[model samples]
Target: MLIKVCLNGGRLRRDHPAVPLTPAELAADAAACVAVGAGAVHMHPRDADGNETLAPTEIAAAVAAVRAACPGTPVGVSTGVWISDGDPDARWHTVSTWGSLPAADRPDFASVNVGEPGFTALAELLLELGVAVEPGVWSTDDAEHLAESGVAARCLRILVEIIGVPADLAPSLAERILTRLDDLGVEGERLLHGEEAATWPMVEMAARLGLATRIGLEDTVSGPGGVNVPNNSALVRLAARMGA
Candidate 1:
């Protein structure tokens, strides 16, 4: 199973002392997680002011650093709509700038949320740049959107991401999303994951179902049994122990 360590999302230094924001910090944290058995890495590249950015320079810096730290591990970044404040046109413009970056400095793959505006166009752009696209399906509706959008078959994988739900309900919600995808004949590799309160349950569920799952400060700051985690490596270690 592929256990990707999400280094950080829109998290800030106040969210966790070890929340990696700078390129060097992301590189160090990614190396640590990879050393502990994380098969891949996903992170939101941050600007100098500690905010998520889709700028090519910032993305290149983060991707290149992580690649140097963990030579063969796959590195992915978020093309979240919020980075551009929901302006699809601006997001596309900024991402288009990435074409100027050397291949080595580009993300191996990028997570494009299907529910976001202009997601298909963005995914198409990523493909044009030779980057694999991992479509993020946060709900059954998102799954349906992905199916209807005609990009499911071409994607590197489908991210069945469940968020804003209670732990007790996560697995069933995930099942519903999976079932929806299956019913729609959305054939492709799928990575199941949940955020915040639902993180570990989804991890265990993913392990039980033999699917890829991810964990890190971006998903939760607490470990199983609600213990506070010290860093991304610690979360990866615990997930590894759980057979993720």
Candidate 2:
């Protein structure tokens, strides 16, 4: 099992200027996260504009930067449809229409936002290209779909995103998520990340359950304890204690 922390990069600048977006900044942050016990990380690479992008050039730079600093820690990136809408395809073109880039330019793992048009096709392409899939099962309904479709076998990892209005009421949501995964017969290792302030609760739940967990600025800028988190490493340190 692996504990993954997110270095949201550019997205964090607006919400928290301290979030590192440049490769140099990312290298430093990656080292910090690894030191605190995160064996994996999810990243969002940004261009000079400070917006999300997965362009192979940017991807290679970001991946290389993280690896240079963190050594063997696994790196994952977003292929989210919302990245730019592509062209005439709008919401559908994202992963499907993205022009090809070599494997070295790609992250080891990428997400399949379940139900996103062309996501399954992208997953197939990613698999063929030697990239691992980390499907993002956002809601309970998404998990149920995976259960029925035997989708777990198609990916390298499963990322259960605890999302809701009130959101991630701790072990309550975590227990519910786990039970659903159980029902689905999801046998492999999985990680949990929550939307907004829900991130900490999911980490706590994962710790109690002895499952791999996650933390990130994308999930919450605040500390798990409600203090202002200076960086992702701070979040990882807090989460690691739970596992200890």
Candidate 3:
């Protein structure tokens, strides 16, 4: 199974001391996670203030640094609307600037949430920019939306991201979304993951289903036993032990 390490999401230093917020820090964390069995990297590039940003410079620096640290390991970034204050147009503009980045500095792929406004346009732009699009499907509705949009077939993979659900219920929720995608003929590689309380359960579920899964401070701050995890590498190590 492919276990991608999400170095950070919108997390701050207050959330975890080890959350990598700088280009060098992200590089170090990516190297450590890859050493511990993480096969790929997903991260949210942050500005100097530690807030997520879609700025081309920040994105280029983050992607370049991580790729340097873990050569040949795929590196991906988030295009979540929250980074653009929920303004799809602003997000589009920032992402459009990524085309100016040199090929080596650009992300290998980027996650674009299907539920967000202008998701289709964002995905199209990323495709045109020579970046693979990973469609993030948060619910059955998003799965149906992805299927209807005809973009699922072009995505690097579908991210079955289960968030805001209880751990016990998350696996079943993920199942429903997966079933919906399957029924709609949305077939390809699928990566399953969850946030907060649902993280570990979904990780185990993904392993059981033989699907790709991800882990890191982006998904949770704790290990499978609910203990506070020290860093992204620790989470990847534990997930690796679980056969992720």
Q: Would you estimate the TM-scores of all the predictions? A: 0.98, 0.88, 0.98
Number of clashes in model 2? 0
- What global local distance difference test value does model 2 have? 0.73
- lDDT per residue, candidate 2, 1-244, as tens digits? 3678888833656798668888788878888989989898788888887788766677778888887787777888877776755432443344433346655556788877775656666677667667788887776777776665545787877778776634536556666766787887886777876767677777777777678877777777887567987888887888788789
For candidate 1, which ten residues in a row score worst on lDDT?
Answer: 235-244
Report clash pairs, candidate 3.
Answer: none
**Which candidate, 2 or 3, would have the higher lDDT against the true structure?**
3
lDDT of 3 by residue, 82-118 (tens): 8999999999998999999998999999999999999
Query: Superposing every Cα of model 3 onto the true structure, what RMSD results?
Result: 0.8
lDDT of 1 by residue, 1-244 (tens): 7899999998887888889999999999999999998999999999888889999999999999999999999999999999999899999999999999999999999999999999999999999998999999999999999999987899998999998999999988999999999999999888999999899999888888889999999999989989988999999999988883
